[model samples]
Target: MKLFSLKKTFFLIIVLLGLTATSFAISNDALRQQLKLFSETLSYINANYIEVPDQKELIYGAIQGMLSSLDPHSAFMKPETYQDFQTDTRGEFGGLGIQIAVRDRVLTIIAPIEDTPAYEAGLKAGDRIIRVEGETTEGMSVMDAIKVLRGEPGTDVTITIWREGLNVGKDFTITRDIIKVNSVRSKRYGDIGYIRISNFNENTSRELRNELDKLEKKPIQGVVLDLRNNPGGLLSQAIEVASAFIEPGKLIVYTEGRTATRNELSARRFDDKDRDYPMVVLVNQGSASASEIVSGALQDYQRAIVMGTTTFGKASVQTVIPLSDGSGMRLTTAEYFTPKGRAIQDVGIVPDIKVRSGKVVSDESSMDRVSPSAVPEHLMSDSEELDSDNGAPEDDLQLLRALDVLKALNAFGGTYSRN
Candidate 1:
């Protein structure tokens, strides 16, 4: 939602480029001819048109047309469009709160965010959205389907979904809520520290560090890093997180764009402070981008045991280039790879353990609904506190499985401890 001051920065860059480049100069003759052609086209369009056109709309259309020729990520977003981006990334949108990705023409549910309306509505990991409000979504774009699903909070929207082995389409009348995605959820479950990351945002690294410090003071066994529904955020945050458990001087991730300027990133040399904790990272089809960067690097280095399904393969790095105007373009500038030099584009990281979230439920009866007081005294420490309610207690079977593994590892004294 914050406006970035990039006009001056762009102008400065242009000035520097002009000074550096001696041979590659724009000819005045060619520029004059291009301007003449542009004026002629504009005149022609204005003189012979079916309907009167707005000048601003024409300019926006031209910009949109140009951007459409580029990659899918490079888009011309209006003020409202930017607001939509903010709502989605913050996970505070007024909608079903279910992340969907279209593949094979079917809108499949990614892992629903914890404590969201969608999670509460019993949406599972692999449920297919067949219809919304009575309209068929057979040939709709992902963006269009998302728009139809979002509305004023407290309003109800009926969604028809088809899941595996289900002969009949399941209809869910879900209420729209002001979904605020709590990026991090941490608590001591028995001897292990359970950390659920909904997404890797700007505050993620700090949140994770604070949670770990709390757990470190107690009799902690190990930590379960749940990255199941995370769509990922800033690359810097991902590297910071991966550096916590991984050794210094290791390759965390690397980027390769067409230009040499936007190329490399490596891990630090001495991240020995938070390096002595056994970790199990939970990932699924929704874990992607910066999430993959952290999980893939950890998995390659054997720093953490990855559990759940394969990641949502998104390895492209976007560079936000602002124009002279307030609007900007988020262009996919690079392809990223894991530390072990594996391309994660379309090919995600395979977890050490694979567990599905299972079938979708329709009502609250399927959830366990653990209260804050339900966490036994043995489960909490002076520094650690439990969340008020257990999140999607039934649909989060993958997280439960990961916790079980961590508990077992603790029994074997495999929770990494430094001498």
Candidate 2:
């Protein structure tokens, strides 16, 4: 029975090799040489290894290595990992609630989802996760790190993080919970409407439309769309968001890939005319993927004055192909481009007006003798006020800047109209 198992494995390997050779159009001689080398290496390891390795593990490792060599985003997802990934897209899952990626070969935090355990614990963007549960993450894949960080709710996971402007690495013990993301939040600043998007999920577009409808009830002079710390999600949601503001029949974004079937996603004519209000978009280094797509499209069309810092620049489109073993492959299948033909892969969207975030004021004298309760909530300093429910500080310097820009546009004879 053992001999038969080995023979079946050998046959499977040969069949896989033949398929690869045929797909790539490799010459018969070259294909034979490659297969011979692979067979010899397998035999040598099986015969001379100090400890026998599991055949399945060896094969999985090989597949992982191949995918990792292509790109950081492309990866082989084991069956369990694939299941967790599907759960994540539904907007509720048990985890740290931080979007992470392997940036510069380090496990880096892209953005912490708002109101989640990680965000409430003050885990900032660009923080490097050095250790998880005392185990080093030096050679760990993004998916592996995710597995360790996420588990049953009510569990605790300690992670050591190295951050900029810090002398020593800090360890944080975060309790996992079911993360439900509220993608859109809105506030009225007299005639200006401020909307903050935490992340793009399935409900993002609908939530944004609902918020916009509520804001439209009041007189709106201008709009500030904040995309700071927004680690992007579904591409379809991004398209829907952009369609809300952009004109019908306008090209929002186009993608190019090796195959023609999955390329080019253009904007559909969802409405008669675009929203004709002066607009400013706020973005920062944490804004990535779908966030970049929306901001890039608006900027290219001159529909909005993009403010704040540059974006995170994750412009590749990944497609998940399921395997027969219940596993799957998340492959970087295409590169997306803005309407003006600008590539945002590693080069992020540059803001029209660059404004750095202002420092939080902690001085008591700056309060201007008015009692905290007497002062209007929007007029109070962000540092002095905290959201009661989430305990997260509402420090939004970028939003303030966007409002200022909108006011300026409104003042100058309403020059920046959305035509």
Candidate 3:
């Protein structure tokens, strides 16, 4: 019996070795073939093309296609594109200062950053950018349009916009300026403290902390955190911000991926500031990435009342890997889950109070739009006629409703039982 067992062990070892060898050989062959195919395709495109395509554009397009094929978030970044990303994360850039994204192959305005040139020039969300400086934006990528938008401070750029609900398209000749995004905008509406966070960038946590601290000294009955039209940023910042409301040692988020170490981010002990305040978080289709982390964690832990539309449903974590050539890859590395082990990829967080804001041209009265607190039109969208206190006409109407919810919670004196 002993002899037979030893033979069986030896056979298993040999089989494992054979499998490893085969896998390694297959991987090498696959890589070689891919490289050869890339070379051939590039050569063919350059040698024979209708318009004599720019070599740099062709190379960048290939890289973008390669990454985009993996997932929507993973993307290639050239030097300028990478720089624009850095500026965005830093919460500052030079442009008309409008938040934009590509949807259906068109540049759609998500929102206008407060006090920016875009907001001042009457730019509104849902505006379709058709032409930039007389150049049609039909075949342009988001990064390409951004490059055209960004320029030296005080420069002017003409943007042709096809706005929804408008009788005729509008043209805005906006002068560029240095857009310094506060990232976190805070105020006191009656007894409720309201805070609007644009993104979870590197300085997000610190900015949020400062804002929270400012409200702590006041007799603020409740707080509203608005995270709408935020594309998300640093993961660490998300955890830090969530920890402010949740108790220590609570699981905030976790991530798992093939061949990646499973990571669990928990809320650590904070300084106990504003721990007893009733909190309401707002989110929408524009809230994603790190914003999802905060909203998901808060909702799962039952630490706050979430009021808004469904979140953006981006639960994948990306790592920006910088190469030697100043280019980088925003690669999706892992899928994140809330503390309840619920995957949010393609499934966004459901709000406790689901409210729908009115459209720009809807016949509904301003009273039909519900906000926890009274908000003026200028506080949200740039337009006067469409903008109303009910929070319609703004891209992030869900967040405004969340502020209203916080005001309601404040009126309840933090004594209402959460169901």
Candidate 4:
């Protein structure tokens, strides 16, 4: 059986060499030489190694090395890891509830989901995860780190984090839980509508539509769409959210790859004209991917004014393809651009009006002091914690600026073209 396996492997290599000769520009002779060298190395390792090694593991490692050389986002996942990847889109998973990415070859926190153990523990965006359970995460992939960070509910793991302002890494011990993301929330600021999208998930579109339905019942002149600290999720949900405001069949985002010329995605939902009130979109350094798509598309169309700090700037599109062994690979096939051809890869969407982070304080000494209690319980900010929630302060500086601009737009009674 073992001899047969070795023969089959060499046979597969020969087939690959033949395919490579026809597909690639490299000379067939040189390519054949390289394949021969690889086969010899594998054959030697299998025969002369002190102990027998798992052939499956050896193959998986080779695939991972190849993909890792391409980009940080492209990775080879094992069967179990691929299963977890599917669960992520549903927005219900057992873990710390933080979106992470490998930026500059370091495991960086994109954003901590609200109402999760990680967010409540005060994990902020741009924080680097240095260690997990006392094990250094120095050379760990994002998927490996995720496996260690997640476990059965009620269990706990300690992660050491390093942030920009911190002198040294800090350790945080948080319990695992089934994080069910309530991606959309809303509030009313008098005549203005406030829709806060924490992240784009499968539930986001349905929830956002419901929120929009509720807001439409009221006479809202404008809306403040808050997307601060929102590490974006499913791309489909991003288009759906944009379609709530942008009319049908208009370009929302376009992607281009080496082999592919252009693939354009457009707003599809109808009845967007009714929600075409003057709008202000709120974003910050934590808002990325799908978040950038919606914000950039709106800005390009002049449909809304974006306010607050710049976005997190993740514009690469990852395509997950399954392999024969139930494992898979997430390959970075293309980079995405906004409708007006603005690239968002490392260059995040710049807000039309930049507002510094601050608290909005009315005349505290005046008799008209609006205390925290004065604000209705239902009208409270969507921030999980006051420290990390850039969009929600007692009275948010960015939110106030957005409302002020929307109010101004309402006063001007301007009419803009729809998709």
Candidate 5:
């Protein structure tokens, strides 16, 4: 933080900002008066306060308050938090490994990264984290929630969450670990390929390219590109990953804001791999940002049948600005659009085939009689992992639905038509 005269600190800061009411066309004198009022308020507080307040904290608090008023996504990060933010994009962190957002002033889980403590604990998307380590998260900022959830690896933090089916909130104890993600994982189901993209990190596009290449060698009939629970990362990776399926010279995703220029990005690579086969892109509420870009592009071109629930719909682009004090602030700069010029801000991409996730228990199975949420935390347990092969088989209804659609497309010679 740069030094400012104590009495005229707010006044000088405002003048340095040179902010004007552009839309309203308020005069320079009016703006100065507003700045003067701010300085006066601060001066009054400082002169008559019970104790000498830390001037640095006062400035930082002011910045945070201003950012918070802008939007849920924009936030002022302290130096340590800014450092952690940089580490997260590189795909490794000492944290709980969950993507979160603030919705309606409540802390909500976007998705838990695969193979992490949160995922292993069975924390699902749309789960409202009411408390973290007994601290109420009712109005906590996403950055603050992150600070609490992340710490030295091997430390434990218990969170209380409320889900749809549960009558009351449930507590889940999760141990923080070094979250190192291998973004792309694949399984071969006959002539069809099932690829689960857990999260899009620095290496997502490279990982995906290698996986697609390996699968193309076998010449699969169709492919299931799963983006369910993938809280997206790196816009560059989104474009690169989408390039694998979308044709070169075709628009993948674009962004525009009031002040920012419209960034029109298109696919660049096509010859290295053959991608004419039928595809089923699986998405859910957990699918956000980069995941939206991929699925939206594929759907817009009619290249794939999108299945599962609607996406998380985080279309706004945040530009992280580093401050002089090693701190930083993420400011919302733009809103992204799909190839078909669809604005996906609050309204997410809708799937062609809507399939909710659940297992179809046969009538003969005695366990079919059990209720979904018998107890608060009865939804899932360590022994009853939802995605694990070792646990009691949980049929992926969405995957099955996508496969059925894929087979239909295959039978019709890799072509699909919507009625």
Candidate 6:
């Protein structure tokens, strides 16, 4: 019986080895064929092109094509472009100060930074850039468009924009400037403390804390956190901002990726002196990424009433992978979800209270169009209007609704009174 068992075990082992060897051989053959095909294509292009293309340029173009095929956000940056990207994260750079993205194969303005050349020039959200410097942007990538728009401070660039209501494109000549973003601003609206976060940069949380400290000194009844037209920034800063309101150890946002395990980002610190007053968060189509993270977490916890239009649906987390060269690639590595496991990709966070600002032109439908009379008195402009230093517009309809919501909560003894 022992001899029979040994013979069976040996036979099984031999069969397993044979299967492994066959699988390895098949994989090796497929890889070799693919590499050969790639090499042949490169050789053909190098030999038959009208002009002999630089080998480095050809290789970089190939890399860019591969990354572009993945997603609109993924791109292979040249060395100088990569340097600019790093400088941008530091909250200062020389550019038109407009966040742009390719949406539906058209270069669309995400948002123009307040007080920047783009904002002052009236570049509105949803404005489609058709041409840059007389050159059509039909097949241009976001990074390419950015490169064309950015130049030395005081240099001018002409951009042709296709607005929603206009039949003919309008040309705007804007001079580039050094964009220095002051992410946080605060003001007191009667008894309510109003804070506006323009972007979530490295110093965002610190600036917010300082502003809050100043506001807390007064008899603040409620708080209004404005996040309109904030094309997001650092993920760490988002967590820190959310932690200011939420209790420690509460899950703020979580991320899932192909290679990495699902990771939860929880609030690690809490302010004991922080006011537990009723809160209202203002958001719009231009509030994205880290902005969505903050709003979604607060809404999920019922800690704040999110007021205004739906947010910009950009919940993917991008990781900048530096290449062996000085260049880097911004790759969408993971998708972010709120604490309740709700994905905000493409489908943005629906506001608890829907309030239209009348300043932005919605890309969703023509029905979203507001009459010129409905717009705020300060916002009556053919061009995009810039937010004030306090971040809230004068006579803004959305701000009025948010204040009303906060007042109702305050009147109800700090309880949320949702109708």
TM-score top scorer: 2
Q: How many residue pairs clash in each candidate?
A: 1, 0, 2, 0, 0, 0
Total backbone clashes of model 5? 0
Candidate 6 accuracy as TM-score: 0.83
lDDT of 6 by residue, 158-238 (tens): 999999999999999999999999999998766678999989888998999999999888778788999999989899999
**Superposition TM-score, candidate 4 onto the true structure:** 0.87
TM-scores, all candidates, are 0.69, 0.88, 0.73, 0.87, 0.87, 0.83
Q: Please report how far candidate 1 places residue 164 from its true position, in Å.
A: 4.6
lDDT tens readout by residue for model 3, 334-395: 99999989898878788777876542344676557757356654333322322332333145
What are the Cα lDDT values of the candidates? 0.71, 0.83, 0.73, 0.85, 0.83, 0.83
Model 4, CA-based lDDT: 0.85
**Where is model 1 more than 4 Å wrong at Cα?**
1-50, 53-72, 86-93, 100-109, 126-151, 156-173, 260-262, 267-272, 323-326, 357-419
lDDT of 2 by residue, 278-357 (tens): 89999988999899999999998899999999988889988899988888888998898999899998898999989888
Please name the candidate that would achieve the greatest lDDT relative to the true structure. 4
Report how far residue 213 has shifted in candidate 6, in Å.
0.9
- Tens digits of per-residue lDDT for model 4, 1-419: 97788667757856865786668766757667876787787778777788876778878897888898888889999999988888887878899999998888889998999999999999998899999988888767788778888899999999999998889989999999999999999877666778999999989999988888887786777888999899999999999999988988999999999987899999996454556578999999999999999999999999988889999999898989998889999999999999989999989999988997788776757767557877555334321222232333355788877866765555556554434
Worst 10 residues of 4 by lDDT: 382-391
Which pairs in model 6 have colliding backbones?
none
Give the lowest summed-lDDT range of ten residues in model 2: 383-392
lDDT of 1 at 179: 76
